[model samples]
Target: MPRRVAIIATGQTKHTARRLDVNIRELITEAVTRALQDADLTMRDIDAVLLGNMEPFEGFLFPELWAVEGWGGYMKPSVKFNTGGTVGTTTAIAAYYYVASGIYDVVMAVGFEKQSEGHTQTAITTVGDPIWERSVMAGAIGNFAVMATTYMHESGVTEEQAAKAAVKARRNACLNEYAHLQMPDITVEDVLRSEVLAYPVKRLDMCPQSDGAVAVIFAEESKAQRLAPRPAWIRAVATAHEQQYMGDSPKRLAEMRSLIAASRRAYQAAGITNPRKELDVAEIYEVASFAELAMYENLGFCDRGEGGKLIDMGVTELTGELPVNPSGGVMSTNPIGATALIRVAEAALQIMGKAGRRQVEGARMALATGYGGNAWTDVMILSQEKP
Candidate 1:
């Protein structure tokens, strides 16, 4: 017997470099209130809460316990999970389980990151062990740069091909109302000529730190029918964790073994054969231009090492075969811990036809993927109709 879970409500705050307008409680309230309105329900309708966050980034040990009340959890059952960048998607899966397992009728899944309030780079640097790896690794961008070099060397991808992805993302970001980075008139030549941050990775090639919050309501099938006219249902979800050390495997090992394996299980469970043909839209976690190209191969859109070809041919653009990261993706609006769940939420919004100007045309099926912590991975398949 399979249980059914659907997202009946979705809400988000404006993504910005710094949010001095509201406190944490106010930010939480803004998203939750909007979700309730979208579901045509009230706070009283929620049965539990699941929060996703990376505490170290905010220098707070247990912000979830204190912020639960603001998320409308109050005395209700509430808990938070931290899994590097996978926290958001991981939290959403937990909320869905709470509903599908008959433990809760409605669960509020929320993820937020106020990078402006904390030292994000220092927090990210701590992901690697301080004994050896931390001293050598510059940080996320540095690690990504090394990986990008490997990708270029292996796949024979030109720097200009990867630069195109950056231009497309910033262009898409301009259409995203909640997006903080908007470069409507950007071009590949512009990214190629931008200031280099970490060799292959340029200042313009990387995503910006953002302060934002996103909330969605997960309801049992019966409750979903009463909440919204149409709901984006969760068909299949899978999570896989890899070794913690960066040197444990080859440079691109995580992309193939951890990320791709989880996606295979998710796609198989969702009855998908060809992702390029089956998925109408996708929101992937690609913090850099090369990562997006690598994702095209990892997600089965193309063969291994052919990801660069996909970008060069303009296959990932909004009007391409499969519209990817139409909401500008993590590359355009990264909120770190909230990024994975933002992918999930953005995909759901596309399926619900609520993505505004960034929405894909006639999108019926969508996918969202999360990758972080060197080895941790989570892939989720969502649809306008159930599997």
Candidate 2:
């Protein structure tokens, strides 16, 4: 069995539509510097560095080679991941293994994306099967629009319910200093009136392309205890992937097979028989408003098609039975590559009792998830107590 590993520190840059003030390298350095400071350690203390980003989105290949100095990986062992949106959490899991295997004492994982520097939609169009789905694909919005329509037809989920989710996410972003969209006064009415991007999906209902970076430090039990007053222990991790072709699963978004499988495995490994009751908070990757509701069911927070009811009952509010996306989630700040890692970082902050204004009172356990490429899911559980 792998040894215990804990998150010692986490840091993120202020997310925005465009970060013209700094280049990609500087953007990465900002997050890395803050993480090292938060851990009360220097570059010399990091045994290895792991980084990830959606290279196509940034029009760059082999980014780590030129950006190494910015993340302090000049002479340390380093690896990079480029898995579409799940790159962030994938990189974090890699760091966890590095420490858990007893090969490294301290590891830093970083994920970033400068979407403004490249053609995001054009890049995303290439994700589909080149010979089969590429020509007809209209990027993520078109794909999600179809999914949203299917969900509404089968589950009676109205556009208003999705609007409520959009309002909740942007409102929550008001309390987060680093969030890109801080709409404290946003309402369901405003979301309903927003320009329709794709049928059943409005402009406010989708996540924006953002520029940002996130860095996190993982350490073995002994070093973690010495570094952080309250370390977020990694209790369990699970990942699942399915056939890449969208046509392979016609009801893909509604079923979300990968998310269900990954969450089930993670819950079993964490000894969580009842996730809604056992997990204190969750920071799920909700790329679109409707996706959040779908996740509530797939993650076993509620029965299928009952996601809308959870939001209506305030069950997932900041002060409810389980708070979801208190950091505003991907809806408020989606840097694609860093978005998933941000979910993990936010969960760790809650477990460490370091989440400011948006903190969940006395949170002891938290769940985070990563979704990508229409069929991949990554689930991680963190807790204040050792597992």
Candidate 3:
């Protein structure tokens, strides 16, 4: 049998459009230090260090080579990861595997990105296949806009419903200290009236590029008990990826095949029959408001095409039965490389009873997701009890 793993601590820096005061290396250190303090442990307690970042977004090559000290990986085994939008959670999942495999007792995963330091659009454009996807989708916004349109047509989800999701995210963000957007008074009207980025995807409907860092500590079952009063046990994790080109599947966003498969696999492994009622909270990488609606269907939070109805009913709100994105989600604070990892960290925080104002009351089981890299996805389940 595989050894059990649990998340002992999580740390995150204030997310903002810019972090001019500190370099990327310093930003990395801030989250790492906080994770160590949160766990009440030093570098000596960590067996290895793993980092996740979008190297192109920061215009840095071999970032880990120079920023080793930032992650406290000096003279210790270390690794780096970059999987587009999924980098953060991918890092956490990899660390979980390391500890659960019994090869390492404790591991730290860090996700960082300094979008202000480089041209995100240019860097993103460079990632395309240069021939196929470039013609089908202009860029990230264009890609999602097309996806949102498909969902709108298929599900009959109205613009009002998407705005409601934006309203919920921004309002919830006000209660989170590390979130980038803090629009406490934002309303559906505000989202509807906001500038349109691409068709149905309005300014508020989309997530902003921000600079931030997040870190989480994973430990073996025995070490987790001593590291934190309440450890968030890893229940199950799954990853799925679609074909690299959008031309291969134009209905990618509407179908969300990767998310559907990954989430189902995770649910099966976690022994969850009904996700809508069984899971307490979710921290999904909802890159856009419409994407969140689509996710509701794909994640089985609601029947297909009923996502609009679910949001309208406020089923995923903070006080809802199964509150989702109580940490404001990706729409509220997105640091690209660190965005998906924030989902894991926030979910773990909920299980640890340290989510403070954004705490899902009495949360026991949480679902976290990461979505990026040609429509790939990673889903993880965290439980308050050993799984």
Off by over 4 Å in 1: 248-250, 253-255
Q: Model 2, clash count?
A: 0
Best by TM-score: 2
> Which candidate, 1 or 3, would have the higher lDDT against the true structure?
3
Q: What digit string (tens of lDDT, one per residue) describes model 3 on residues 91-158?
A: 98999899988899999999999999998877887778886566555558877787788889999999
Which ten contiguous residues of candidate 1 have the minimum total lDDT?
A: 247-256
TM per candidate comes to: 0.97, 0.99, 0.98
- Per-residue lDDT of 1-387 in model 2, one digit per residue for the tens? 899999999989999999999999999999999999999999999999999899988887778998887777888999999888789989988999999999999999999999999999999988887887889875898888888888877667788988888888998898899899989999999999999998999999999889999999999999999999999999999999987766645477678999999999999999999999999999999898888888898899999889899889989989899999999999999998899999999999999999999999999999999999779999999999999
Task: Quantify all predictions' global Cα lDDT against the true fold.
Answer: 0.84, 0.91, 0.91
The C-alpha stretches of model 2 lying farther than 4 A from their native spots are none
Residue lDDT tens for model 1, 295-365: 88888998887887898787888989998899888878877767888888889889888889998989988
**Which ten residues in a row are the worst by lDDT in model 3?**
245-254
How many clashing residue pairs are found in candidate 1?
0
